[model samples]
Target: MRTNILLASLVVLGFACQPTKQKEETASTPEKIAVPVLTKAWETDTVLLTSESVIYDEFRDVLYVSNINAVPPTAKDDDGFISIISTDGEILELNWVNEISAPKGMGIIDSSLFVTNIDEVVEIDIPSGVIVGRYPINGAKFLNDISISSGNEVFISDTGTNTIHVLNNGDVRSWLNDSSLVGPNGLLHQGSHLMVASYGGNEFSRIDINTKMRETITDSIPGGDGIVSYGDHYFVSNWNGEVHFVDTAGNRTLVLDTKTKGQNAADICYIPEKKLLLVPTFFGKSIVAYEVK
Candidate 1:
């Protein structure tokens, strides 16, 4: 009887000590990322004169477009100007600010608007529509885009030299020169990082503001020009007239393709509150608006 009790106890211990049936390892399903559809809402007249970038001024409820009136983009022609348009696509002031040479990307800091030229960052007084300052970046080859950080520091990208220059408190300096820049064109300053759209490698990447470490989000976009955040995803435009919606996992979905139409998509802007996308057609000479659904 004691032996039977001992055997029963041993069996109970063995059962208790036995590992639970390991659940079969299953591959996790990728989170479903919704691809947004873009519907053409409005397009301004084709008189923008090689509009290269469009930025919305929320305070004024207007849109600012940079017109590189000269070809070869790097030309120091004095005809480049900034145009102002109403949110409803009406031309407010065709030459709100002129005399800029090959202006490309622009950002507004408080009452001042900063724009990227060939080797200089021009600061414009928004209310007065006057060019207040021009900060020249030394050794800058082709300054392409401008993004202002929360701290009001203006960051500019140079595609010709794979460099990034910064303007802080009237001081202009070369901030970064990484080979990984690969013709960085468009810059968007997020909270802790800057999103870069590369024209050479056809890549969209992020650079940590603190560490300066570069992380590629995708490399499939050809002639990447503009980048805008949409929730956790992004909307990036190709200089060849293709706009792609990129998910968190780097998967891209083509949202707009104007390549066949011979239209070029340059630096783009997104208005989250209205779910509106503003695309600058470089050669098309127009600002196209689309409602993203």
Candidate 2:
């Protein structure tokens, strides 16, 4: 997650309006997509210090939250930790694994949990809660998010350097570093494409895994932090505490906003089976659950 200090100048861009509005129809107008309604289901206590990212483990039926317990997000304090929480918004273990330094995004492949630290990816054995592997990326400034493919390939985003690094087989290398990847933060692997949410600008792009072709789906949401797919639509969050719904036609609608309340929406996770959207408030120190309907 981008620190509030770095994004202090960026004003909140949330609409703070109704979500179920339809545009006037015209002969050449693309079909308007229906935006889902978000209802607050539950919110955790304000105890998760600087919660940056949250991921759901289907097998364990729990949630993992990354806490950057440092002043500056890039600080190598070695005090960062991962918390395990229940689906009902109860934090089970505040420091389930505390050996990481400034841990951010997380992904799991089999029984191994891969999380990005300042400049390296740390793997933990979930079953045993032991540190298993550490893959350091040279020249990596700030590693942010992790997305694992079906083939067990790990993809990580470095926000400070504007690059995406991959861990294939046993080697960690820079995968894509393009001008369009402005502060790439959130990554989601979709079949043959990787959906990227850039923080530096209003850019939501799709990259082909095989050909490395880049396609811009939309460029209207700023401070993009986390992304989740909802059929052909998508739910994207901004670090400034707003969530927007993006349709297949690139139309965006404001679905939720908490900036006015001084809450920060960091990296988010979605559970399709439960139709729940989990938002980790960075400074608010809590996870808010919203029912997607």
Candidate 3:
């Protein structure tokens, strides 16, 4: 009789809590995914010769282009330089910072602009456009893209050696040298995750910052050169003059292509406020902007 009474009381309690639990479940449900589109807005003139990457500064309404005028990207002959252009497609100052050797990709922390030059992270003061310092990785080879986390942790990809190096303040060291990196070229650092675009291996991977767990996002971007986040989608660029849009589910859509023209979309940058994508055409010698619709 006591067991029966207790079971009845438990059933009543469960029923009493049902509505609240349902309400909590509904509140925790994820929102409907967003599908974004893109349209070519306006492209800058073909003035950035051998430009490998583009990064935008909204406060100054300027874009920085990393140009490797040298033939081979691995060359450390100091011919590489950076170009500054206005957002309105005007050349503010060509060869803006001319002290690096093969500056490929760039990131910024506060007023400092950091670029990967050969095997070092070269820091340049944004306002003065002066080369501040260079933090060399002890054994990095062909350092490619750079991405900075919200905490100011700098992560650089070494495409030549299949490694990822980390820089905190002035210290530099190889953080992840896993085979899963597979020629990491373009890096996008989010709050809790790090996304890698493997150009040589032609794959997209995401690594958890805390757990270090890796997952393959996709393998559609052949010659994957650049990656930028947009809403719930990711914009990817191929060195062969193609840009693709990929969703979290691994679905891909070809948004732009200039392969027939022999133009290379090396590294891309996105300005979220203006909904514009800046694409640095390596061989095309141009910085093109596209509108995200």
Candidate 4:
């Protein structure tokens, strides 16, 4: 009778230990799955002029790009223009809008398109591509990127000034005046915070619009130029031809690296509906698209 009891106790002990062993095995397993890097979904043929930046419009299903190079060799004009391309990588139209000089980063709000030039912000009418008005900044040099707030306030980065400025009703004020903001290139509005990419500092920062407090989330990125937010993740690209995916908690991992020469991955935009990422390469002279998945 005692031997029989020992056998039953051993069986119960084995069953209890089974769950612990399974738990250990499960805890040791890796949770992060490697996302497969995909080939370039599409690449536009070399345009007549060099392309400097790109932005995607999900509502219109179009990609707007800024071409800074002069088309005619002897035109004696450095006036920049915008180009509209389809998602399939076809140049739908060239010279969609002409007359803006050295247009760079661009953003759309409603039917209005905002573009930054050498020292001013030019607001253009979308369909017509006509310059409606211009906001000029004194002592401002190299207006790099612009982002619009829900309140209709436009935030611009002055790389030369190493400051971020806000424009409301033509009244300009310094939103962030710090040396760490040097070479601020891209701006994106996330919730009530403003995400700024500083190329000179090689960092990504989040600014509380309400409190005016700044927080540096990352400083390890090289050549940080453009940034965009998708869901809970923020994607930032460096001019060195690499893209980094960062989570809300400040964890970052390399998403993509291109062999394309020229550290000029100037701007990037995400189109959620199509799961597409639009990147404009300054040296590549072309816009490349990749599947977000």
Q: Output the number of the lDDT-best candidate.
A: 1
Screening candidate 3 with a backbone cut-off below 3 angstroms (N, C-alpha, C), the clashing residue pairs are none
- In terms of TM-score, which candidate is strongest? 1
Give all TM-scores, in the order shown.
0.90, 0.88, 0.87, 0.84
Per-residue error (Å), model 1, residue 61: 0.2
At residue 5, candidate 4 shows an lDDT of: 100
Please state the error at residue 176 of candidate 4 in Å.
1.7
Per-residue accuracy of model 3 over 1-293 as CA lDDT, tens digit each: 99999999999999999999999878865555555666777777787769999998767788889999877988888988999988867888888899787999999888999999988899999999899999988788889999999989899999988899999999987878887666889999988899999987789888998888888888878788899998867998988999888887877888888889877889999999888988888988888888888
Model 4: how far residue 222 lies from native, Å = 2.0
lDDT (tens digit, per residue) of candidate 2 on 135-160: 98999998998999898999999998
**If the candidates were sorted by their lDDT against the true structure, best first, what order would they fall in?**
1, 2, 3, 4
Candidate closer to the true structure by TM-score (higher is better), 1 or 3: 1
Score candidate 3 by lDDT. Answer: 0.87
Q: Lowest summed lDDT over 10 consecutive residues: which window, candidate 1?
A: 18-27
lDDT of each candidate versus the true structure:
0.90, 0.89, 0.87, 0.80
lDDT at 141, model 3: 89
How far residue 247's Cα lies from its native spot in candidate 4, in Å, is 2.0
Q: Give the TM-score of candidate 4.
A: 0.84
Candidate 2: C-alpha lDDT: 0.89
176-206 in candidate 4: lDDT tens per residue?
A: 7777676888899766899988888888889
